[model samples]
Target: MTGPFGATSTTDDVLAGVTLTGKRILVTGVSAGLGVETARVLAAHGATVVGAARDLDKAKAATEVVRAQAAQGGSLELVALDLANLASVRACADGLVAAGKSFDLVIANAGVMACPKSFTADGFETQFGTNHLGHFVLVNRIAKLFAPGSRLVNLASSGHRFSDVNLDDPNFEHTAYTEFGAYGRSKTANVLFAVEFDRRHKAGGVRATAVHPGGIQTELGRHMTPEVTQAMIESINVANSAGGAPAFAWKTIPQGAATSVWAGVVAAADAVGGRYCEDCHVAEIVDGEGLRGGVRPYALDAENAKALWAKSEEMVAEAF
Candidate 1:
């Protein structure tokens, strides 16, 4: 069921009148931007949020508002997780499983966008490793922590419009690499992860979905030079204005995080499970060139998703 919301709705707007008094959520990347706002708003609605970040100190400083504004019984705690390092990822997930806390939601929100080519501590491509594989291991390792009716929201991006995953040369080993190409691959993986995860767990009432939070002004673009950023912005605006649509505009952080909140707690489970969403509603499948929005069929392919899952397990040397 689509709701009375659009690209501009903020997290609070989507969550209005909904109380999360006893809900426990695990949100990755609480150190800044959408992550912080998502945690703050959820806590204000009385949900206990366990925030994960690479820099625990930065996360604590940034999440002060989450603590101060929390509704009664709502709280926030910081956990150490460097998504680039598999050892750290496993340790964090293991610790959480040992703690025995059940989570109503897990938002895989932390990611590095379009950074220079680099390898993770585990030797995988950086963007794919951190944004997709890191969360892959962490989430599956703690799979037992998912409460019945739980949800997983993977923060994908419109940048997925750039390209699909290059499983053959994920590290750019034999293929040339462009920053956006790498980013696109990772974002696509985020969607496929949701598709496969939702299929695997929905029977047990645990749903998974992918969301594009809309373009927002945030530190996620730190890697791009000002000129490149401006160029990308202009390109997006050009695309946005097609078909008489409004020119592109950066969403406020709250607005950018809204779809995640909506999918996690507000949308009907059957409506969003295994689907892609944006602007607080399920998105349609898009095709052809000069495209403005919507998901690509390849991203939603069940067989490809399963294949990625198998490849991911083989790469990480762990089975979920």
Candidate 2:
């Protein structure tokens, strides 16, 4: 469903006049980019935010502005997490559960973009492991802390259109690995994870949705050279032209994070539950080779989401 806001909306735009005095939110990847900005807006509006990062020092340095700008009852706290390693993921989840910390929202926003072929601390491919499996284990383990009316927003991308999850060879053991392809698989998992998680918990008033932040110039591109960045932009423009859509344009950090905040805090729960969102609205589903907008059908398929959930449990040797 379309909303009052669109691509140009900032986090503050969606959150205007909203008070979150008792809202407790957990945001991953708080060290930089959209994560920091998302936390900033939420906390600025009176929510208590717990920011998680792989490196506490980096997060500490990066989030000084968040602390400085927070108002109302807003506050920031940091937690150590390493999404590439299950041991660290479990420890973090266990610590939160042990502390009896409850959350009204959990944003799975940390992820690695296209990077050179590598493996995570686990045997899974780098992107698949760090971006998907890690959050899978961590979120599932800590879900007991999610009270009814809570929400989970996974940071997905339009890149899910690049490829669906290759469930059979999720680790790339039998498939040739390309940076974006693996990233695509992981992003798709982010969306599918939301679908399944929402299905599993929505009856109890918990819902999950995934959002694409749109293109932004951020540290997320640290692995890409200027030439590669240009090439990707050109490719996106070409596809947009084919679809008669507006050419690709980069959004500011605030604009990029608006959809996540909108979906997580402002939008009606039923509109986003178990769906994919972008541009601060529920995204339509599209098919074919086009990548200008909309989500792929398979990413929202109930059967596929269930299958991926089961396979994820098998790969991680844990059940939710």
Candidate 3:
């Protein structure tokens, strides 16, 4: 089924005429850009939104932006959540549970990109740890607190096209680390996480979705060097000059976040669990569109997803 909106659709467009009165939503990475915009739209629609960020000050700023844009100036709360640390993830989850609150929507929108090689508190590679495993642990820890009909949206990226999980040496213990490779592997993991989560929790009326928010200028690119940015711009320009690259496109923050918000609230997607989505639609199987926008084969493979889930369970066994 087609998504309720398209790549051009904004968060406001997604929430238009929609009412989220009394619903509780938790959006990570809500400090700026699409995350902030999403929180704004949700609050405007009457959802009680908890905007999670690593920086309390940034979260406060983001909440203020939401309030400024809200028609009713609905509930907006801020809390600290750092996906790089297992203890932090536990603390965040524990705090939420301590509040005696259950969430109808949990948007795992926080992520790191092609950062230099580093390790988390658990000694896992930075990208995989922060972008995938942290959220993995978070969702599992809080699975019990999800209200019926709850939706979990994992903010995946088309960058998964660059690579899949390097299961043999996920942390680069025996091999060299490349920034983009680590980012790609983490992105693939994000999709697999959603697939497996949906498989495990869908029976309880909890649905999971992985979304590629499309390209937008956000603080996400802050880590990119000038050379990297230039190369990216050159690639896009080349693609545009050649008719348009299949893997690359430009979107405003609102447009970029449409797919995520759509996945969260669209009734049509209730039955669309465990799939990769883009442009606010369930992506078509990519065959000829390898150069165009569509999910990569490995990222959407059920077996790979299940395997990754098992591997993640082992990697975080201590936490569980």
Q: What's the ranking of the predictions by TM-score, best on top?
A: 2, 1, 3
Assess every candidate by TM-score. 0.98, 0.98, 0.92
**Model 3: per-residue lDDT, tens digit, 2-44?**
3357878887777777888889999999888888888988888
lDDT of 1 by residue, 52-170 (tens): 99999899999999999999699999999999999999999999999999999999999999999999999998999999999999999999899999999999988888888877778
Instruction: Spell out the clash pairs found in candidate 3.
Output: 246-291, 246-292
Error of 1 at 269 (Å): 0.6
**True-vs-predicted CA distance for residue 286, candidate 2, Å:** 0.8
lDDT of 3 at 124: 93
lDDT of 2 at 71: 88
The number of clashing residue pairs in each candidate reads 0, 0, 2
In angstroms, the error of model 1 at 300 is 0.7
Scored by lDDT, model 3 comes in at: 0.84
State residue 310's C-alpha deviation in candidate 1, in Å.
0.7
TM-score of 2: 0.98
Off by over 4 Å in 1: none
| Residue-pair clashes, model 3 | 2
Q: Which residue runs of candidate 2 sit more than 4 Å off their true CA positions?
A: 1-3
lDDT by candidate, in order shown: 0.92, 0.93, 0.84
